[model samples]
Target: MNKVSLLSSSVRQQSLQAVALLVFLVMGLSGAMGPTLIPAIRVVFGLGLSSAMTVQWIPLVVSGLSSLILAQLLHRFGAKAMVLGGLGLMTVGCLQVRLAILAPFGLDARYGLMLLALAVIALGTSVIQVAANLLVVQLGHARTASARLTLAQSFNSLGVLVGVSLGTTFALGAKTTTAPTMALGIGQAFGWSGAINAAVLAAAAMVAAGAWGVSRTSQAGQAPIRAALGSGWALAGAGGIALYVGAEGSIGSILIPFLHQKSVLNLTLEQAGHYLGWFYWGGALAGRLAGTWLLHRGAPAKWLGMAALGAVIASALAALGSGPVAGYAALTIGLFNAIMFPVIFSITVERSAAPSAAVSGLLSTAIAGGAILSALVGWTGEHFGFAVCFLVPMLAYGLIALFAGFGALLPSVDKAPQDSRMTSSVGNLSERT
Candidate 1:
């Protein structure tokens, strides 16, 4: 078949869409569990706020470096093998965390081990996210890729919601912040998640055995990594995506505590977190649903600009408003942020066809922006208070908004159909398992 016909054939399968959606939800469960583990880790390990946040960065650091290597891995192993490998790593990492936490040890020693375990888990998650996202876009519709990402990510938010709630409940009922308590509680949690993930990974592996090359075209054969990295637009889009993720992560990490401290609502940490989840994840879910459709009618840049404007305005108002009103306004920004990451990623992916693999890796690395931006916000919150800390994300959104409005231009690919924007920098492949 011709390249166009081949790619079209790949996109016409409803089963592919079902698998993408299913895997995304499972991935979401794992991803969402990550943030909730943060607070529990802090309480059990007695780590400071900055230190606790650093744990979150481990995934980004590992993922960033790993993403750089994915192009090579894809070339060597193919997308199916690489994805299963990532999933296997994730399962192993989770099991290790569970074992480490359950180990009998001194507080300091246990804390060190916990951090190490978290690092391992982060590495696995990074690979999974990068693989899953690329696969979804590759196997699904092009114009609707961003929307599908948004919809899938909404499940990720739901996973977070469930994890935090469960984590907090288990944490609260646990013993002192001693090593043993941490070990027992966290270990159990990891154990459960690990077992579940292992089952999923095993199933994915079985499916992949039958699914390799299910969607690949002759034109989709390997491209040089250097060529993919050279696309200026892809790199720029990656930067924007990085900044956007950082802003969102920072906000989500700190906003609940900020609201509790400054607002007249006078809620507890758990209460604040729950409300934050509703505002953040709930809005995220809604926005993604809406954004999926919006991308078809308007330019991504325009929609991004609008989302950014909403974030800035809502955040600014939340900063100014007192009592419950201010808190709600601040929470409203989650709605705006809901679609930011997927949209930025989709735009970047759409703009360049020369380096699909490299571009995916580069864009995945942009997640590091979360670590840097969140730290900045935490610092600002310490010195200036929660309201002013938001200024950091506001600036981030503003720049991204500008990019959406004028700085970015989506190029039209001439020959390739499935993803004319494919780049050797990153390969967009579907996960059949």
Candidate 2:
């Protein structure tokens, strides 16, 4: 390529990267509301705690299952179309959610319609995630994508921070005694979500139309799902991502109530919401920024392992301690939770013998962990109480620490044999000097 052409290509790639990051940020914003606005949802629908928690877990199940087909969908539609379509879907889903909340239906009907709307939102989110992950890989080699993805995740955390503030201030801000006011607040929040999605959809479409030829090309010849199924890295990474997503989500989902307990912070709901946004999710944003810097330096596996261990300890403290100690402990887990997903994702992409798109698609399916583990966390909280609910994430984090260690033992790209299929630790260790 000529210098001008190369410069042009570079500029267009940069533009796409920005678009992908925006998608991740909005996805976080939209996703955070479900968990953070549970209080308002209960007030509107007259749900118990466990039932309100379904707003998060059930839709997460839909997203995870929908993601299983991402690679196939991408092969058929390409990244640009998927991104645009996903944004549109999210826009409509948000509107649907608002309408569902406003519907003058009986309790069972209202709950079911809202769940369906959230499922639409989840499906859209699933598509955006797969497309964004793939776009980053296409922009550069998958081997080097860890740091980039981590940087992008920082924006995702930023969105979470914003979402928490908005959900608490708007949705949960209404007086619980006034049903109409509470419903209006929820409607306003959903309106914001729908408007943002629409704006992003327009922006993405404009950029893609004016920019490069990258997303215009098709994913031909290879079946990512098939390739991912055969790869051990994909298998292990899938498990780790599932646990990591679930564990992180589990903690965020419960932070408000956990902090509100008199045994803990003894704070009001509003005060607890601040802690959730600033301390828990805010710590997450800061950690991702720090992790972005650290990942650029090296030793992502070691860093991943260390972070997971930190989360394990923090979660244990949250479960076993009381007063401010447990409050602080629960908050610190967000700090440790920061680097887990991007690091796990980048490592798997770098090491997997499977196609990168296939691996990414496969890993997306593991987001079902959010649904499965969230349900367990809620159930445990209902039956065994907060102590046991916190432990659910503790176990999940522990498994991720082990997964990080396992990845650590694997041969890195520089050290691996020419025969890439020989991935066993023993197989690689025997060949080492």
Candidate 3:
């Protein structure tokens, strides 16, 4: 190719990579919005705490199951198609939820509709998670894949922060009315639902625009799904991912409530929630930004091990200490969690015998741990206390530490030979400089 052509090609590739980051940002926004919307759902439907929790967990379980099945279809459809389809599903799901909230239907009927909408959203998210992770790996060089994934995830954190803030502002700010005919005004209840739907639609439009920019590459020659599933290293990596997500989710889900305890931070619920964002999610964004640089300089496994250790220590301090010390220790866990997903994901993809799609699918399935571990922590908190519940994540972090420390010794699929076609293309692109 000529110099100008080469530069254009390079720009195209970079643009496609930016699309993946945008996808991650959308995923983060939807993920955060789900849990944050629970209280609003409860108010609109007059649901008890346990019933509200059931509504929250349903989507997680669906997402996990969908990921396993979606993995099988990746080779047939390709990443571009899957990503676009996933975004479409999210757009539809959000619209359904929004319409359901605005409908004149009874609360019970609307609740059922909401569940169905969330399930659709979950399925879409699962597909996007699988496709985006694999696509990011393909978009970058193997040596810097971890760094690239982490950097992209930093945008994910930014999305989460924005989603949480918006959800809280629009949904939680809804005012109750004294009107006899309506306990809660329609306008108030639908505010967040409308906002969420609009956001999802906007994201879908972005994904559609970017979809036209990337080539429709196929994975027909990659390793089969069966072989990837059988790989021991892939399984180990999946376990580590599960545990890490479980630990991170459990801690984050409880942070606000834990800090609200009289003996702990003794803050109001809103105050505790605000601090949760700053110390937990905000710390995650900072850590990911820093971790991108750290991963570029050292082995990902070593960094993973160190991060796991930090989580263990932080959880222990949160569990055993009291007052501000406990609160700070609890929030500090987010810092360590920042890189685990990307590092474990990159390591699994690099080492797995399966194609990137199969590995990504399996890894995405492990995210169900968030639902499982969060429930466990909730039970522990009810029976014992929030301090005691910290042990659940602490144990999870301990296992992750072991995995990152020694699990590499296990056998894995040899790295795929570099494709000459891709190399030549990249080389030609670089010549423009």
Candidate 4:
């Protein structure tokens, strides 16, 4: 069998892809608890909307700042080391947060510690994201990069579904912020999450050991920030990434209350939590699974535009309608959001003259938009109501649709197809998985 050299080891490219995919799954399973646990954070802290939003915003801010430096770190260290180290940091951070939750410290102190702990997890996740996306993109055929990344992200969504369901289970019917029982449940949730990450870390190390040659990362492997800065398209794509992340977070941050509205599902907190896990996140999973084909055979530019347009329509309808109409419209936003990130990323990398690391770092930093726009949405929801706040993401989606049109006109460059492939590649592997 032919082997592509990752670092210096002769190994199947699929091995590297597998490692990236597994790490993404673990990251989603545990590292992404902030959004899912907001209800519990609020209930436990007696926080109002603006304050509770910090649970998510703190992580977003940290992840964005960390992303700005990750490319340099990857260049200084190596992908294989970065992967293992990233997973380890996530485990420690989760455990640290668990302790913060269970500690007997004063409310303000404990809350502050929890925020800091999440920032650690955010940095860890940012590392894994850069490594994972680079691995998959570098190993695949140029044309199918979007479809490949989308397929990988579906596993991420599956992990989120399980993670959110776990959160909903532990957090249901908790009435008092001061209750020790409620606090223990949330703490234990993080404890279990930490364990899962630890296990994944061990698995990651064993898998990465095969490619220790990453001690000498290839030139293409080290995408410098300066290279990414030179491309106007990459910068624009980063803005699109920021908007998409912010828009998605806005809906998710307030989904509990949005669904609880009589104008929507009128569900209780617990019921709304269940609906969120199964419907909103699940819709994203299903859409991405199906979208793999559409993006594979169909044009990425067209698909990107269509998905953004669908999000716009869904956001508007949810804002204006009531009952099931409004409820389902909100859920469908997840479906439309499915392809936006992967497609936008692939398009940017394809069109930019920069290396993958450089481009991806810029794009990932744009995720700070989650903090910025989610705060805006929180303020809008606090005053205007949750349903009306849908207008915020609606405008975001409209802008993304415009960005898609703009990206289409640029020529593809910096396209990385690591090897010619011995057989049908990402598409075939995706089918088997």
Candidate 5:
């Protein structure tokens, strides 16, 4: 290739990776929207709080199962197929939810269909996450893979921020209006459902475009699933990922409730809730941006260790202290959490003997810890106190610190030559297409 052709090819490669970032952004948006969607569902369906909570778990359990299944499937089909499949499923799922809500059906019927829609969405999310994580890693230089993924994840945080904002605006802020066909209050809360549908459709379209652009690209070779399952380091990395997600989820889940306590920040429920986006997720966004630079300059494993240690100290301060000190400590943990996932995933994939898809699948499956750990924190908070519940995440973060330290001792794999060959192969394929 000529100099200009080479430069253009590089640009095309990066642009293609941006598609994965967009998918991540949509994933983040969908995730943040779930909590906001629940209350709206409650109002629309006339369900109690306990019943509404089921909406949260359905996606988590489904996504975990989907990741495991798709991981195995990747051995037969390439990442391109998986990405396209995920996007199609998500689009269909979102459409289903929207249509179900609009249908003039009874509450029970609508609720059942809504649950099905969520399951489809979650399954699609799992497939996209597994494929995209591997795709971003394959598209970049092996040395800066962590930084690349972190940068892409920064957009994920941005998506969360935007999703939260939109959900609040359209869902919570929706005004009640009369509908000739339905009950008086039903039409008002349904606005959020419509908004969610529109957003999902837009995201799906973007992903479809991305999928088309990369259709000719090739995925990394698959290693034996048995080898991946048996590797101690991969298992440890998976455990660490689960722990990290659990810790982060536990903290975010309780932040508002904890802040409402008189002994803590004693903020009103509204004020405390607002801090979730401003401090918790905003800090996360900042951390990822900073982490991108840090990972480029320093060792990813060492940085992961230091960030986990920071989280441990912050969790301790939040647990042990009261007033603003505790509140700030609790929120700042998001900053430390920002880079751990990408760093852990990159390091784990590099060190593992299994193929990238297998390692990614194992790591992605570990995200179920969010549900598990959140339940633990809730149980602990109910029995003990919310402040004391910080102990759970503190313990989780401590373990992550140890995992990162151990990971630092392992040998790194150089996949640059393989990546370059893949890139050339992709270029040739693209030209033929």
Candidate 6:
């Protein structure tokens, strides 16, 4: 390709990157809105704690399974089809929940359908996430892969922030009780949060559908999924992403509750949320900025190691205390997690001997760890306490530390023998050293 053609191709490629970012924002919003509304949904539907948590787990399973299944879908039908399909699934799921509100059915019947809706949304978001993550890395310039993914994930955090803010606000406003009472009865406050989420999902689907043509042009051919799964570095990288995402989600998800349980500042639910939001928003923004900076400084693995250490320390501090200080520590771990998946993913993609789609599929499947780890923490919280519950994430962080220190020591998974003809299909297409 000539210089102009290359430039135009680059622009088209980055446009797809932008689309991926949009998908993350929508999925992130949908994923978070359900959790925010759980309290209200539980009260209105008369569900128990384990039941509410079970609703949360459903999404994780759906998302993970979809990621695993989607590789074939993308390989067969293409990323555009998968992206639009995911949006369609999420739209259907949200509508199901919205319809439940208007129905005359019994509470148990209504809640059961709502739970099913959440699962469908989860599966849809998972498909979108898998496709988007893979596309950004595959289509973008090779050297800038980390930068591309980081930019997209920053938007993911933005979605979470929006979801939490809107969910909490609407939930609180829907109640007739005093703010303090409403906050205390968290379940009563989240009823309308569900409806609000449905609106957002609809808007997102429209945007995704409009951009479908642009993203379809970016899809490229790739090797088989089975071959990619067999690669060692690809699997390790996926494991790294899984551990990082799970630890980050588990810690962030519980920060507000952990803060409210304390006596030091004795924060109300709203106040606790304000503090928790800062932790999430702060870590997300700061970590992404720092990750960009560190990528430029060289030695990405060293940076990864340092961040893992920070996680270990943060977990320890949060474990030792329960008040404002512990809350801060737990939230700050977002900073550590911010760069993890991007950094690890970049490394994996660079090292992959298999097709880009295969690598992306493995990483996407790893996201299921969020569901597994979250449930594990929930179990621990029930048996012991929140502080102790964090021990599971602490272990995940520790494993990340080991990976950062020794990732290079591990062998590559590509079955192809080392050859000068070996080439990277995605990004700038630069020859490996």
- Give the candidate number with the greatest TM-score: 2
Over the stretch 1-433, how does candidate 4's per-residue lDDT look in tens digits?
Answer: 3244322332434556666777878777775567777767876777888888888787778878888688677766767777888899889988888899889998888889999888888888888887677656555567888888898888888877777777777765466434576677677777878888898888778766653324442433456688888879888898899899889877877887888888788998778888887898898889889988888788888889999999999999999988999988998898999989889988998888777778878888888877888898888888988888899999999999999998778767744443111111222222232
List the global CA lDDT of all models: 0.66, 0.78, 0.70, 0.78, 0.71, 0.65
Q: TM-score of the candidate numbered 1?
A: 0.85
lDDT, candidate 2, 315-383, per-residue tens? 999999999999999999999999899989878877787776677788888888677888888888888
Q: Candidate 1, 412: how far from true, in Å?
A: 3.1
lDDT of 1 by residue, 315-432 (tens): 7776677787767878888899877888787777767765566667788877766678878776777677777877888888888887786434556343244334322212343322
The TM-score-based order of candidates, best leading, equals 2, 4, 3, 1, 5, 6
lDDT of 6 at 142: 58
Model 2 Cα shift for residue 54 (angstroms) = 1.0
Model 6 weakest 10-residue run by lDDT? 417-426
Instruction: Tell me model 3's lDDT, rounded to 2 decimals.
Output: 0.70
Better of 3 and 6 by TM-score: 3
- Residue 277 of model 3 has an lDDT of 67
Residue 255 displacement in candidate 3 (angstroms): 2.1
User: Which residue window of length 10 is worst by lDDT in model 4?
Assistant: 419-428
The per-candidate count of clashes, in order, stands at 21, 0, 0, 0, 0, 6
- RMSD, each candidate, Å? 4.6, 5.8, 4.0, 4.0, 4.7, 4.9
User: Where does the lowest 10-residue lDDT sum fall in candidate 3?
Assistant: 419-428
Clashing pairs in 6: 39-187, 40-187, 142-427, 142-428, 171-189, 232-413
